[model samples]
Target: MTNNKKRQRVPHHPTSTLYSADTSRSESSLKLCRLTSNSSFNDNSTADVILRLYVDSSSPFVWDSTAEDEVQIYLHSDLLHRSKYFAALLSDRWQNPVSNINGINSDNDKKFIRLNFDVSSPTPSSISDHMTVLQLLYTDDFSSVINSVTVALDLLPVALKLLFEDCVKACVKFIEAVPWTEEEEKRVIEIIPLIREEQSRELLSRLYAPDDSCEEMLNGLIMSAIHNHPNTASVKAFVAKLLREFASRESARRVLERAFEESLKVVKESLEEYSSPDFRGDTCETEAIQRLNLHTAMTNGRHLVWLVERMIELRVADSAVKEWIEQAEFTVNLQRTFRDDAWRNIVPGLPSVVMRCTCKLANGVAGGTILATRQVRMKLVKDWLPVLIVCKDNVSPLVPSQKALYLDLEETFLRIISTLPMSDAQELLQQCLSFSTKNLEDCPHLIRAFNTWFRRATQPSLTGDHC
Candidate 1:
């Protein structure tokens, strides 16, 4: 589009006088504020609109990211038309500036930022006044203006000292608009907070897609979003939604619990740290934080499934878990694939099923063995068992009642034994019951349980098995 046909810009004008319903023009101005709050941009100006990005000085990756954000906003929102953007950032105590964002398309240092201010096209005289003012602001200030790219780097102190809200806002908005790959996303994730509540929410909304790729990298987004702007409506909704996912899948649920717990620890610590020596003194901010904490806890209760339902209930977000469950269901002729089904089908005289157990190790080497109990879970792919008894140790001596659970479980084995009459199921059970403790090996219960299960659960119609 030619500059000749482009719309005109609004000139700088500020009002010191107060406005009230008693005056017609003042009422109109109040209406504008309401409109702007909802619509973001006005037909006249984006002067009040702010985009902020919080960048870390220590991160080399943030330097370019911060500049890109600023440039995106400058390119999209006209400076002459009254839009502002900046990156708010933090630095180490010894660091000169928290972030350094100076990649301003320098053709031997011409500061291409001026090109954006020029409004791009030659146009009329009277309407050009607004553009002219901006041009002057850009040119005379060649060395004076903080380049959007440079501010995050060499000029963050000056930017903040000058309260350069516009530059900060632009950077954050650019992050919101641009798509970031996983590698790129991590670099910019931290600063979502130092911006404002509104900008942070925009960032998380973008991050919370929960795509398979997103699942792995959600920590930075969730932690920073909740930490900086927990009160934002968007953030509130997001936390609740995450809790739902946690409740759904065991893996996701576990991660969610840990994250929520960490967040709660922080909250509790802050309350303790900032507490006054009164009997729970009343105040708005504290009350708000308290209410938020309560809401999260209450939500967790409603959302977290009990241990029995946790593993058994059918919510499988992980590919591996889904595969295991599918195989488990197939034992009942439900035909769920266990492992690679084609491979397992060829096992001669065997039940064409695969059961694998996983013992998840904690972190490094020494966090091993006994610590692996919570991690050691059994996967009965072909038959996840009508019941899976996860215990402190799978073979802890069965209590009197637990012994009954074993005796009672014989019904399943007997039923199966009755069906597999041609096979040695009956003999297997007799030997299993009388099996020496020395031969129990690593799977005494499993052997005993299989014997009991075969005898108890019977569907007797197998013609070829006898062959």
Candidate 2:
């Protein structure tokens, strides 16, 4: 019994071998030892350092209960020295070399140095809560490095407070290496202000910025910025840069057009109601009315015109731009409200914008060829001539500039018709005549052009045999 008790007191285990001053280990051998070891203080051998880890019931790492309120684990001083926290504290404690100090309890029976740590339920609950940090600290199991990112993020502050640089780096590398979900990105952004490391925040920002894979996220971030910080110069610059990029992408253009259409709806509704006799009030009722100056902006035509010009400047495909313009429901809306005395005149340059897009369509190159296809030219003429004719008739009391534009349009129409085969030209002219008669309008210029062309076309001199 006496020999067994003595054996228990002076443990002969791997932990004892690790801290044995008599044992000599090379740096590489020590590294290998650390890499292979799973237990914190291997073998429970003659422990020179005792760590009394007082933990809440939530702790995931198990410890022996010494008393009702105390839990303890025996460790080697050499292993504890690996941590900067313990290294600094032990350095101070060694300078004094006192067995007992006030506020620090000691066990005379154990004959070992003691350090106390308090981990509560609220902070640093367990290895479960900070798996990355604890894994980095205790084991070679780095498999959790990527999968345990939230654990790493949570442990960063704790690691920093503990002065654990290795753990800090592990947390940062975990964050940097992994891709983030949208919610994780939002959480990171929320916590950015709290992080003291400038480099970490920069890494986070680089990660958060939208790439091609996250265009929707980019749009959402921009809208959030506009809503939350409308006057921020950096945000405005970002928006401008993003707008330039989006101008060339059909999907992005469609999104912008949809947003603009909705905004237009809000503004127009408010303006239409603003003129009503029953609408007399100074109080703001709807958000759209309160925030959007629809009457002023729409009346001056600056907002919509700027959007159209941007599309033009970006050289968006002419057909797509024209289709978007049509989808805006602008002509239909304007027709309904234009006759209202309340409407602030017409949206200026509306016709000019359409005409410019038409010209671009008339000049596009075909696939595998440098010249514009004849089919495209015919389609352009067929689509636009009718619209111009209607605009000339319905857009009331045409100004001199608009009338001159109509005349030019007539000239272009005749020139286009002249390029077609006689049979096709005759058919197109007959169709034009049918349209003129059905609409009950005396378009004398159009009728005269069509009649002269038809008469010349049937003269039989054009289709003579060439022997």
Among the numbered candidates, top TM-score falls to 2
Worst 10 residues of 1 by lDDT: 356-365
**lDDT (10s digit) by residue, model 2, range 1-467:** 13111111223356432221111221212332244344443344445566544445545544443322333455655555556887877776664434422244445555556666654434433322332243245544433332455655666665665666766666677777787777767756765665567647666667556555455754565455434565655774676577677644765565455544544454445444544445444565642342243444343243334344444444444444344334334443444334433323434444543443343333332221123345544555665655665565566676777666666556555556666667666666654553343443535667666777868866877445763
Per-model TM-score on C-alpha atoms: 0.24, 0.38
Please list the residue runs of candidate 1 whose C-alpha ends up more than 4 Å from where it truly belongs after superposition: 1-309, 315-399, 418-421, 432-467
At residue 9, give the lDDT of candidate 2: 27
lDDT of the structure predicted as candidate 1: 0.33
Candidate 2, which segments miss by more than 4 Å at Cα? 1-46, 55-71, 95-108, 121-124, 127-135, 138-147, 190-202, 207-387, 390-467
Worst ten-residue run, lDDT, model 2? 20-29
Each model's C-alpha lDDT?
0.33, 0.49
RMSD of 2: 16.6
